[model samples]
Target: MALTAYEQGLLAVQRREFAAAREQLESAGDDPRAVLLLGQLAGEGLGEPVDAAKKLSLYERAAELGSAEAAYNLGAAHANEQRYKVSLDWYRRGAELGQSGALRMIGVMYATGQGVEADDVEAERFLLAAAASGDHLASFDLGTLFAYQRQDPVMAAQWFLRAAKEGSAPAWRELELLVPRLRELPAGDTRARTMLGVILAFHLDERDAGAELLEVSVAEGDPEAQRSLAFLLHDNAGLPDDKARAMVLFRTAAEAGDGYGAYNLGVAASDPHEAVRWLRQAAEAGVPESYPQLADRLSELDVDEEALRWYVRGAEDGHKECMFAAACWYRDGFGGPVDLVQALRWYLSLLEVGSGDGIHEAHKIVSKMTDDQIHEAGRLAGQILAADVLVVSRRT
Candidate 1:
């Protein structure tokens, strides 16, 4: 009867009936499997808003009863909620019990100072444990840490290669970018083919090799690698810059929802008519870079209203250039009516982000205005610059 109840809950989950699944699973007793299923259902919100509290409760219960999956899930949920100290505790417990994912999470927390004081040596120790256990994600994290955080490119390359061999698509892509420098190393001899495969897949101008590697990765369901190779073949970035081929690759990557691929395709279209089409597609897909470029392109075409709208979008998306451009337009009435107050606000915002051009232009504009306006602008700029100086000092 209990098994039937659990099976029914699973079926309800499959059919997206969250309420029914939760009801059924709750009655399935304290079985670890049932609790895990219930927690996942609550966490994902198949039919309700995510109840993180409930999910955490269920996972904690199951974990206390010795379910490895539950322990890992509990730790992850805590980490996501930024309860880092609690997450570290759960992760350490799970890691001690031989959970590779937990070990990796602990490593990341130590490295990032999420809940604990950052300790690179401890992070590396935990990461090495996870890597030795064949955790591909852990290996990738370690590689990225060495490459970007620690500035140890040699160790970074080695960990990246290990992760790539373990089928980490991002690591493979990053390795493609790093391989040129890696080849200069004496130890690169043994990794020639793997490096070559990444190059052919992402950076080389040889379609045959790129296409072959792409096809293999695609068949193997490596989305990022497939997208990279497709881009190379389609843009002739790998072969000879063929627009037709690039369009095909762009279409494929776009369909698969690759954000950068969609943005690149939008940029490559060149036709103002098609620019809006691809740019809108990429923007809707959450590519922030697409908004500013689309605004600039529209401005070039003299489509002022559309351009201004996209500029606002770009500004909202935190593009410094777009903010400066929009501020100028507002100051001079280029696309819409002039509004000095709005222009000043936007310029000040841009200055906050360290846009020298925006700050200079804003100062020049204010200088020509009434003496009162000049004083106000100067005061605002001084405040912003003071804050920036404080931030820089803290970092140092």
Candidate 2:
């Protein structure tokens, strides 16, 4: 039997032949999966360049054919652009079909009152349902709701622990901060108990108790406790100075993949090169501030190539200042040969992000370019924009 156009489209998609996929999918006429796939390709900025209007049209058709994912995607698109009421409507449609992400988003809307009244009960109900359906965001949202809105530390701790088990870094961060309050809970949670003891000892001037508790936690390899103890020892506000031990603690935290710990180590490095080394580690570990700092330091040292590299890194991570700096470097030939096309690409990327004060500068550069060069710049800019969209969509 001849394969259906939809099946052919799927095969094309699997082979990364997006244009063929689009052609086959479009020919599949009224098939929900085909429409959905086409919508995703256009909307996601993945295989095809972004075409927001085309995406919406295809998604609408797919949703009309009972595609829950299409409904959810519409909800997400509107939500991202802050069209909350429209987002809520689309989310409700998906949620009615038992979509976990839609349910989770509806819970968030209730929690934040973005498109509805703030209702913790409703939020909890929807989030619990979504969580039960295997939505990790629901777990994180539950943690935030209990911790922040409800002010129920014990409940928050429970959800946060659940989220942490699912690899949530924010959950772990919250758990660390909530340590002091966790002491009010029963003694069953040993980690919380340990953290509370350390907090009391350090903050309440119970140095001996803090030290003992911290020693236990540190021995158990608690990175948060290690970081806290490092700061306490380094500051020596209420205890004896132990700079060497503090340094060791920082190293331990950095080695354990803690971004802030790496940042602290970078700040403490006496040698400029050593500082850059640590700062690079921090930046790569997801510390946003470290990117600009590293780039600035490299610039000061006249290491234009490395500075541009760092600036580009930060720019790709959505740092506006770094985007401008990178574009400037590209345009002025500071780091390498002047590449007006690449510079134009960065400048257009900045404008697309809705930040760049360099619009006039970009225009000036365009004025200097030939017609063909300007057209090439626009083409490169589209690629950059589409690539950025794909990155953000995947991450979110």
Best by TM-score: 2
> What TM-score would every model get versus the actual structure?
0.45, 0.51
For candidate 1, write residues 106-199 as lDDT tens digits. 8998899989999888899999998877576998999888877786655776688778766788986777666666556553233333344556
Model 2 lDDT, residue 327, Cα? 83
Candidate 2 ranges beyond 4 A from true positions? 1-58, 62-139, 142-181, 184-190, 193-216, 231-246, 297-306, 348-356, 370-396
User: How far is 193's C-alpha from truth in model 1 (Å)?
Assistant: 14
lDDT of 2 by residue, 99-203 (tens): 899999999999999888889999999999999887987898998998899987767866876787678878777877776667667655546655565545644
Candidate 2 Cα RMSD after full superposition onto the native fold (Å) = 12.5
Clashes of each: 5, 0
What lDDT would candidate 1 get against the real structure?
0.70
Model 1 lDDT, residue 303, Cα:
88
